[model samples]
Target chain A: MTQPIEKIETPKGERFIIPIGPQHPALKEPGHFEFTVDGETVKDATVRLGYVHRGIEKATESRNYIQNLYLLERICGICSHTHAMTYSLGVEKLAGVEAPPRAQAIRVIVAELERIHSHMLWLGVAAHEAGFDTLFMYSWRDRETVMDLLELLSGNRVNYSANVLGGVKFDITPEQAGDVLKGLDFLEGRNRHYLDVVSNDALLLGRIRGVGVMTQADAERLGAIGPTARASGVALDVRIDAPYIAYKDFQPALITETAGDLEARFKVRVREIEESIRLIRLLLEHLPEGELVARMPRRIPAGEAISRVEAPRGEAFYFIKSNGTDTPARVKVRTPTIFNMATVLSLAKGLQLADMPMILVGIDPCFSCNDRMVTVREAERAETWTWNELREHGIKVYQR
Target chain B: MSNLVDQITAGLKTWARVNSPWVIHFNSGSCNGCDIEILATLTPRYDLERFGVKLQGSPRHADVLVCTGPVTRQARERLIRIYEQMPEPKFVVAVGSCAVSGGVFEGCYNVMGGIDRVIPVHAFIPGCPPRPEAIIDGVVKLLSSLQSPAPVQPIMGPDGGKA
Candidate 1:
């Protein structure tokens, strides 16, 4: 297969290509990235996704609204609720039915819990990539408390299909609320300790400090989202910018960092984890009381609605167009990882070949999440590129 | 004398393989649920490493392939390439409902059914994304079958033969 969008030519030294995906040990999901290296320095990098694409967007067009709800939940398991919630929120907007206040609060609670599970997962994965296995083990161990809480609230763990068409399927009982509060207390201590550890640990600091740097201007220009942008001081969070569902009632505190390095990204995520714990507690304390669901027709009203939610990785934006039929006209999902890919690719250049893994994992490159909508068929051919031609092409594109 | 020696070496190899199974996980096309659960099994909480099940990076160094997700069109060839790269006496455990029967992803344009369609599966751990405990149970079940008296049949196709 042709390596996509990579060219490196340094006449002084020999350059070789290193393909680090599809089945590489370092990556968890299936996405191909080729780094052109001169000695130990990476001169260029290119990414090819769609290895995890299952025609989800196309599949959504065929299925009805109810079926699409279940299908959409499977888009990215870690942020499954966000996908469902986003889809439901958009569908409800088109149908013009407001979800009950109690249900909206319940959605926010689960969303916050999901954020905690996701960040802890990312922390462990990022740490593991940096050869900090001890921290990885410790973080994952603490992650279970949130996992158990999620499973208790919703029957399932990863893909918590809590959001229904107009409301949520589950509600928090007093007993469950108490358990969640206790869980949050334990998690709060652990997160603080982790915050201290990541900031203080010499080993991690050495690896991540000043690595994969992205400035605020570049972050905005590259269109980075979620914690990745927040780390670079972009200060763009969907929950805060545009409140939806329960977010209006319980607003999230925006967390941002100035460094714009790998360490900055780590800090943003860890701090967000703390923020999520606090949000969950506040939601529990002021738990609303009402019916869990509202009635809506199977066929959604003919209209298009946009839904954007802050997923753990970043913004999960969805555009739903209904044609007054059971099936949707178009269901477009722009996952956070894809929005942050340009930033990752730009960061991959001019770094040590060994440090590439850390940069790639810094944004928690969820290929499954990013490539769920786009499908690219790998052609049977080998394409080559020269350094000067690539630079000239880039310059021309920039000039235009 | 030669036959006896051959049997002894084979027995030793089987015993070694049965004892320590190094795993390499590949997410062909999944929701990240099953993959995380698999990683969780490796951490301190579940600690599948305690059973000598190390999650290796290279396919050549590994004995078992812990496959997750449905076989997508773009990933189909790459999945096959990975399966073919593994050393002999290899086993594949299809973890999650998607790998078993394409689960919810079945009939999607890009989905090509289960992992078994592309690779011979020894055990199918059925769950949307199986819990860490369930994943451990599935791995343990596979190990026990390897030690069973009867031969292990990998691919359960209509032809009913071992791969």
Candidate 2:
């Protein structure tokens, strides 16, 4: 059913206000954006997050390391495993214990599988927003293949909770390895079809190409991470740059696209799915043999460690400070979406009202992962102009 | 004759509500897991739509308020606002362990337990992220209770506390 959302015309002047939700249908999560538009062109945009804030960072301070594993996993549903794994990695670093090589390999396997599942889910949602429901249905249907593989290995579908304090919970069996390869085989064919469709489909290309084009310089300056930055040729994949965990052994090729439009972001994600499939197959072949868990102390020594993992959206950074107690003193998370919010707010300026959803999903915004409420001493607010200056300096940026 | 017509129309409303329940989903505070699983049910595989349950985008058009997550401080007012906006005879199905009891987020600074902490819940489906099958079953269970044509009350007490 088509939405009957009415755009009110201000009788005083031509300026119209379009507020897109704390409960609008353009997105699955709640992050409100108000755009002051002139006719069809967007003049200015403002983003208000924290609609889904649950005070996870502060809550982490109270829970012990063992319980916080599951707590942190719920930070973002799509990348729950990445949250748990990243937290465990940091805590392990502080504890001065490395997970067994086999466990590390398992971490990469799960992470890549998650990357595929997440990107596929995003593709379906983005397609649905673009009014192409067929692709949405098709991609989601194919996404189940990877979801099944994840469930087989980790037991749970969404929050795998696979990472233990010192190592992973489950190990891959021969049969599971067979299933992984089988799932990838089916996904490989589907990924190629999707890549072709996103690049060539006339209607899809029209809605995406030359729309929300963020230059490479802009992407870099804005500090966009993951595929959002890679699409603009920024090359900021944390896996390659930092070589965390199994990234050193099973390296992933950085998928970059020169064109930074919505299409480029789409291409970067689709190509990343292809690369994840390749990585999964190789990891399955190597299948390191070792214990899944190492002996970790109940009380971690007093120290601080920062861990970064390449979540499907972008880099998921976790900062853990242990104060010689069972519970951590502070746990800080800087999700990729928070970094891309600047890119999104900037791109939305001067865009048509129709382009807001595309540009918003272009960064694959995850509000729950963000809203952890980190007080950045150095981070400055961009363009805090109230409604007074919103009219005179309502950014007129044109994309060629 | 007037009494008979009134009875028939009320019965029809009950039947229509049970037959096709249009649902509007809200996330007061959730880990996106339950929300995504809820979406998974709408897709072709689980096919909750086969039961004639449509996930409506607006609360105004929805018959059931399907909420996930524990209520958070910031989202409390918005959740209640969405519930209040829906027409009377509305049912609420809170899906997920979090929606049922706040699950892992019970004592967090901003979390206010489950969806029931703010509004009344007609049905509760429990899982870390409940499976699509369980969610379908929960909605069906809620619909089963609405088979009788009693005027659905909001069930708030005189003291503004949960009844």
Candidate 3:
């Protein structure tokens, strides 16, 4: 497997271009990568995305705010709540309304729970990518504990549509609060075990330690964010930097590691899960009392707003513009995966071919979250179309 | 005597296909909700393996093709190619509302409707993303249907004869 894939004679030495994915066993979703290697070491890498592109942002323009909430939530399954929450926050900002304190606290609680589930899921997937099925199975089996808690609270496993326009859809009952606390207790213990395993497991350490090392300067230059950056000693977290929802009141301690390798990424995410558990427990202890939702105007005034939230992967950016109507003029989503993707491609150089999967999953890249736009180039010229032009072209093509 | 031996061998093949189906998952244009749930079904909790299901890495080695989400324009050719690569007597299971009827992504420009729009499906599991248990139930029903002494027909969608 470590053998160079496609050999080509270059000016300096023999070069090899290895194409992976768009359909490959290593990738669960479709994405294409062409990595140029000199022997076993990668020299350059290029990524071609858009296979999972469903034109969601364009589709958002045609739907009203209420409908867009559900549509945007599908941007990512692992971080579905982050998409929904980020969109809701942006739309609420434009409407000049905020959820009540109690609702805000509940939002934070759900957000933290989502972070735990997301991190554990990433841990399982990363372990699986490293060929550690035992760790994968154990982490995922334990992840169901949080999944059941989410199902209990929101009535669905994935895409828990927990947020409404002005506030949340469901309130946490006292019994549900007790159940959440019980679940946290179990997860807290398991997370500690995971932290120990990842930090000390000799077999896993061989694959991850000192592999895919991106220094602090490289991370900053590559624009890495979330745990991928924090693992490299960059302390940039949206919640801590600009506290949204109830994060201001109940702040979770920042966790970072300076190793800047796959091991650091694993440690940071696992420790963050421990932090999430503690934060959720604090929110439940001082559970505020109030209505879950506030009235939102059917027609929001014309305005544009930007909202940023720290999703489990990284900072999820949302841009919303209203045109004095129920529907939005435009909607843009910049997921964290795109920012972290550069780090992986850069780190791929000087590493063994066998380490690519581990390095790729180390960033927790979600291809579904990243694929939003497609660029078509034709005959040395690229044509950019406006809304009207694109509409007309669609009509012409369908008519034909 | 030769005809009798052939009948017994064919019967054994049918029984093995029913008891254990090696499935290969393809994500044409899904939001990742259905894809993850499909993986969850194979994990320890839901444990679809207990029902003799194994997730194969290659389409050629697979007996069933489990597709998620609406088929996209870029992925359409690849989907058909994967379906064609599988050996004879292959089954397709379309999971999720999008795969069955294009759900939320129906009118999206790049999306090409449901999986059935590309390849014929034998079972359709519906949900925003069907629960792992429902996925298991769908696969089980599809396998059990093989017990009958008749060839399985492709489950036709609203617009039939696409296959």
Best of the candidates, TM-score: 3
| Model 2: how far residue A82 lies from native, Å | 0.4
- DockQ of candidate 1 against the true complex: 0.47
- List DockQ, one per candidate, in order: 0.47, 0.50, 0.37
Candidate 2 lDDT, tens digit per residue, A1-400? 2211133233444665555544321122356666776766778877776665677889998888999998999887889999999999999999999999999999999999999999999999888767678998999888888889999998989999889999999999999899889989999999999999999998788789999999999999999888999999997888999998888888999899999999999999999999999999999999889899999987899999999988898888889999998899999998887778788879988887667667877898742122111111123321232211221122211122
* Ranked by lDDT, top first: 3, 1, 2
Top lDDT hit: 3
| C-alpha lDDT of residue B83 in model 2 | 88
Worst 10 residues of 3 chain B by lDDT: B154-163
Tens digits of per-residue lDDT, candidate 3, A139-182, equal 99999999999999999999899999999999999999999999
Docking class of 3: acceptable
Residue runs of model 1 more than 4 Å from their true location after superposition: A1-11, A22-30, A367-400, B156-163
What tens digits encode model 1's per-residue C-alpha lDDT throughout A1-400? 1233334233567666655553321122345677776765778877776555678899999999989999999887788899999999999999989999899999999999999998999998788667677898999999999999999999888888898899999889999999999999999999999999889988788888998899999999999988999999998988999988888988989999999999999999999999988888888888888989988866688999998998988888899998998899999998877777788779888887667667877888753222111112133333433222232332333232
Q: List the residue pairs that clash in candidate 2.
A: none
Ranking by DockQ: 2, 1, 3
TM-score of 1: 0.89
TM-score of chain A of 2: 0.88
Which scores better on TM-score, 2 or 3? 3
The fnat score for candidate 2 comes to: 0.61
Model 2 docking grade: medium
